[model samples]
Target: MTAKPPTPVRRFGSIVGTVLTYVAIWLGLVLLIAGVGIRWFWGRITVRDMMISLQNVDLPAGYTREWQGFYGIVVAPLVIVLILAACHAGHALRVRTRRLGAWDQRPRRQRRRTRALSLGLALILVVTGASVFSSSVGLADFVRASRSTMDIGDYYAAPEVTGSENQRNIVNIYLESGEQTLSDTNLFEKDPYAPLEEQTSDWQSIEDYQQYQGGGWTMAGLVSSQCGIPLKGTIAPWYGGGNTAPPDSIRTYLQGTTCLGDVFKQQGYKNVFMGGARAEFASKDTFLQDHGYDEVKDLDLWKNSGESEKDFRPDWGLSDQRLLDHAKDEIDRLHAESEKTGQPFNLSMLTLDTHEPATAYDYCPVDTESRLISVYQCSMEQVAGYVDYMKDKGYLDDTAVVIQGDHLKHMTSSDSFHEQLDRNDHRSIVNRVWVPGQENKRRLRPGIDQLSMYPTLLEAAGLDIRDHSAGLGVSAFTDAIPGGSAQALGPRGYRELVATDSKDFYTRAWDGEEVHG
Candidate 1:
């Protein structure tokens, strides 16, 4: 009798099995690649950052490009090969099994080979799944541990206007990757921020006090500086969403929260945030606009506002020089508008030239082993020049200029000259407050963090901050309350202050929980 052809049902089942096997293999590979990539790129994966990505928040253009580049270079081709190999193997196994007819009829060697192949693939998938699951559980445990512990207590001063309407024009500049390490003589042959040091030395420096807070990057640093709280993300969906909801919608993230911009808005100040980099990254646009910024102009905004085509967009955004130039012009316009409205203005500027990973724009005189040093030096000159311009324009006379590094340089000890230095000893941001035309005053503040700047911002603008504590941070310029200062917390306490998600008093502020003194 002739061998009967396989039924359509059998054929379909075989095909389905093959497809399922291929899909399983592909998924395993993809998961492995993703975990490895995140680990490599981010150094450490935080729930907050993961949530931001899951929420589909638009990352900066440069970052997006880099991510795509990484995928193209690493994942895409590997996935295709894996899928094809898995499919081929499944098809061959299926054909072999079919030819064998019954499992008992098949040769022992053939049966064992088939069983081994099936078991091997299953084992790989099982292992991969277990790994992913364990990692997720680890993150959850970390969050739980953080939330259970506490450091920052009920440290908030309700920010009442003490004396006069201390509404000085505010020029706040955030230098990217600018750190105290740049000035550490042991780290470099020559100080990279020498120019910045000279300019800001007369201004108030918070070098004596340094502590880790909620700032390790640009966006977090900005939030920490403005809110007197670290930008810690909640595991539960923020802004009234369920736990599994995405964090994409940042517009209402701070609905109940108050920031420096909000305070300025309440005080009748025109708040403007100008940064050369894309403001869309890290929900900066949403955060700033929603907080109280009247105008949030970024590189895209500048381009749309009729900038010359001759200006080539670099990998990041506009160069520091160009950004400062544009900032000067924007300040002039805001000053003019403020004059007409008789309202004080807050000009928030973020520089992009000194950003990390690589230096795309270098215009520094310093000769250094690391390119980052050169970048910082270049930034220093531009910052000093801008300050000088403000002085020449007589803008400084009425402006409270607060120049600070958004965060410590995002380089490993091996990545720079700080390889030999203790991590804690070398990690600090550049903090300087200059009340244009006032005799430069040096305050002996020690062990401060990013949160200190929030109250200090108002203080520099001439407001006498009652009790000096605003939100979770205290002002570096004022006398510290007993439990308020980082010195009181100590280094370990300071780290714990921002590390745990449980500091409801501090984290709740992000969700607009009313902070009481």
Candidate 2:
């Protein structure tokens, strides 16, 4: 006898199960792709960095290739979902033609095949989920760090800056992905930094300039060196109020901390920042403004100033040539203003040509086989020219020029320097300091990291800092190590401390609350 039609409840349950199955499959595919894609694009990244990038979606020009990759990742899942939908629709149609009990009476081989397919998909989902959780999210590390007793706030030292009698003008330049390891002739065909190195031959170089944990990206590097603290996610997910969202979502970027700009501003310095990319990309503008910068000149400034689009690089914003040219003009104006009013100025700039997926500018010579190497050389040449201009104008006689890499190069699988960088064992940040009459005269303390730069930059600019400490950093210009300072932690301890979660300390920092041990 023919079976009665299935009840409404039964049909509803079946439909729910089918929908849930497809949802699970789609989620599984997305996780798998994202896990693999993130690794391919950025190698290994911190959860903090990942979360920050997600919240701040304004990517720089160097990420144009990555944008295309992201588009593929999004489309791939939809395509699979569509195919599955079609197959399920056809199956539903066939099932509709049979009695309710006939589905169970189907061939044993077909039923077994269906079960096997479901089991296979389930296995894939489980494996992908676990892999993504452990590696990409760093679940195990996070748990361990969360339970650790090390408190960053306890090690923190508030800056006590004393103005110098001369009050020298400051020129800070952040070179993108400027690892000194790239200069090793054993690894690379030639040193891309040769031109810039020649210009700063007399400048004091940091012998062991380490890239501390959490300072692996541009914003992090800027914050760490300037504010004397590693840039960490302020949000505590377990807590209800603190959410480490983008800078736009918040009122201020690290309002609780005192930075280089703040100190300079308090010293009556007219602080300004210029860059080859959008200042808003990673909330760099917000950080600068929050930290007492008087003005910001970025991609928007170049665009709005009626500069031709042809002058700008298609990937980021402008070439190093144009950026340095404008920088010269800016310094001239700032210098003239400083001469008129007794107020010194701080001119800070960030170069962008050496960023990943490097593009060759029209002015760059094809001296090297690798486009990355050529672009780096061209960027250095432009920077060297700027340095010469500063020297010619006699700014170097009074100005303190600090040049350093923002971070180590992010070597993806596709990067030209990946293999070479991987082979190197002693990679370090490239840095040079020019302190007025003390050019190449003052010796920086060895084994210092970016954290030490906060006080070092201040001291270089003719300021006297109490205890030779600011935040966790002890001034690298002094041989004396302050008790309970980051330098006193030693290399391994300092590294481990910075790598810890330090959730409460960071939360206080983000909340603009005074943190105590």
**Quick one: best lDDT, which candidate?**
2
How much lDDT does each candidate structure score? 0.66, 0.79
List, residue by residue over 325-421, the lDDT tens digit for candidate 1.
8888888998888778888989998988776654545354546667767777887899988988887888877888888888776533124543433
Question: Where is model 2 more than 4 Å wrong at Cα?
Answer: 1-143, 236-249, 515-517
- Residue pairs with clashing backbones, model 1: 147-502, 209-447, 256-512, 257-512
Residues 1-517, candidate 2: write the lDDT tens digits.
4334557885686577667667777777777777776665555555655655665455346656457556655778778978988997887678857745254455556655775677578568857855884586555555555567887888888888765786789999999998888898888879999999999998888887988765677887898899888877655412212123254334567777788998898998999999989988767888899899999999988989888777787778887889999999999999999889978999999999999787777788777778888889999999999999999999988889999999888654455676666445588999988998744497888768888899998888788888888878888888998777767876656755786767778877778776543
Clashes of 1: 4
Off by over 4 Å in 1: 1-153, 209-211, 236-249, 306-313, 339-341, 360-367, 412-424, 436-439, 442-444, 482-494, 503-517
What is the Å distance of residue 180 in model 1 from its true position? 1.4
